[model samples]
Target: MTTEPQRLQYLEAMGLTAWTARYRMPNARPTEACEWELPVPDDGARQAPGERLHALLDAPAEPSVPAPAAPAAEPRERPPAGERKARALLGGLVPEAASEEAAPGAAPEPARSVESDEPREALRFALQVACLDGRWLVVQPGQAAPSPLAQRLLANLLRAAGVTPEHPPAFEAFHWPQIEGLDVQAPLDEARQGLGAFLAGRARRGWAPERLLVFGDEATLARVLAIDDGRSTALDLPAWQGPALETLAGSAEAKRDLWPRLLDWRREWHGEAKGEAKGDA
Candidate 1:
């Protein structure tokens, strides 16, 4: 059995106003709120629950009273010092700097510069040096070996000058960024030094050539020889710079240009040799 207050609460939840009797019957038990009373019609006619609900719905609603204003709450106290520090440490792990809203009209922080300690990329270059028929020929084939067409053209050019080198000519291939290991910082300087030493060692051994023929970039040859100009006799030897064999093989104009230079160089160097041979004869 539900109590009187619970029964009243159920009726109130159903949108119906509950009423209490003003006077209690002789055999009725006392209610929890004995002093409180509500005047209700005591007509002898008892109505069903549905009829009572309908009558209550038909009745006019009472005027509503405004609730009293609540007092303002006090400001909350700060958390303990240790708790605040722990929260700060946790927040520091994963920084929210990027997520933070930027201030209006404020200058942004400058970007940080990253410094690298690794060695710079190795300098890349390719060349071939050969000693042919008592003459040094510094060639920049731009690869391991010259193309067959370039090689054939070179042989024809040499033959035109009436010079014959030994079969299987001695070739020295020099390439930069060798070994792909340590101690290769100054590659350009190292290349110049290594080539210079090779030439110096050959000269010391009494195999110094009387002439120098370069079939590549003159500027590059000059740098390797530590000379101001490739055409000048700064190395104490007759020198001539000509187009690369690759260029001569493909272009008729290049071959035509090279023929005259080849003839002039051969006459100057070979003529001296011939005159010396005549005197010796």
Candidate 2:
């Protein structure tokens, strides 16, 4: 259990403000401390952003996990709908790249209805990477194109990393099967299995990145790293063979807070790469 002060501190660090329920007993003085309790979902594995953050704050901190031996590729079928919910939550938080289509006066596609049975939940998340050699990989979220804001942010990050915008980089991306809606939660067992399978497939294809720059709430990190502990700027996971850094997801305010830190990290990474080259020489 988390104390009020500690809970408030965690919320503050995550850039969130907590408030009491709209309805309250008459003549009763509302206490902010008492309202700190977050509503938990029925499924223990699938948690709302607030509950996930609390879990992270409450868990004992552990050292980064060591990188494990490379696993051989194996045939595995993708998990079913409910199984993908936990990962979907993280996917929904991260925006992917948008392809620039020059179709002359093509009508805009309609947004998918949340109530529709179509598995659009899987389409809402994406992973993108921009390399220095003018190459980029944009794992597109569902059927939707990346938002303009997401595109700009990715371009900016790549430019800051020394990639020229004009030349751009090789770009590749894929969409996952649509699940239910983003709001649905999956059971813990199913969520873990889905995440494991997804990561395993990516690893087998040599798609593991040295570091993942995650942009979203604390829950996004929890889902990606499969850990429920205190939040940190950096997390090392042997499963991905790298460390991941957390940042504000897609918001103007996040841009202000994240860019400086991202640039600094890029500089350090470049310096380390150069040092390794010099040592080898």
Off by over 4 Å in 1: 1-123, 166-170, 184-187, 200-207, 218-222, 225-228, 232-237, 271-281
Winning model by TM-score: 1
Go through the candidates in order and give each one's C-alpha lDDT: 0.56, 0.42
Model 2 Cα lDDT, one tens digit per residue, 101-207: 33568786778876554322221333433332322222322223445555565667667654453554333332222233333233332333333344444443444
| TM-score per candidate | 0.45, 0.32
| Alpha-carbon shift of residue 199 in model 2 (angstroms) | 2.8
Q: Could you report the Cα RMSD, in angstroms, for every candidate shown? A: 38.4, 30.8
Per-residue accuracy of model 1 over 1-281 as CA lDDT, tens digit each:
44454344334333346666789999887776656333445785467655675565455446455457855454253322343434444454433333135567778878876733444554556677666754555455466677677677777887776566664345566654443454444445555544544465555334457667767674454655543354433455656776777777789998778766655555554565656644643
lDDT of model 1, residue 234: 42
Model 2: residues with Cα > 4 Å off, grouped in runs:
1-145, 163-186, 218-221, 224-253, 271-281
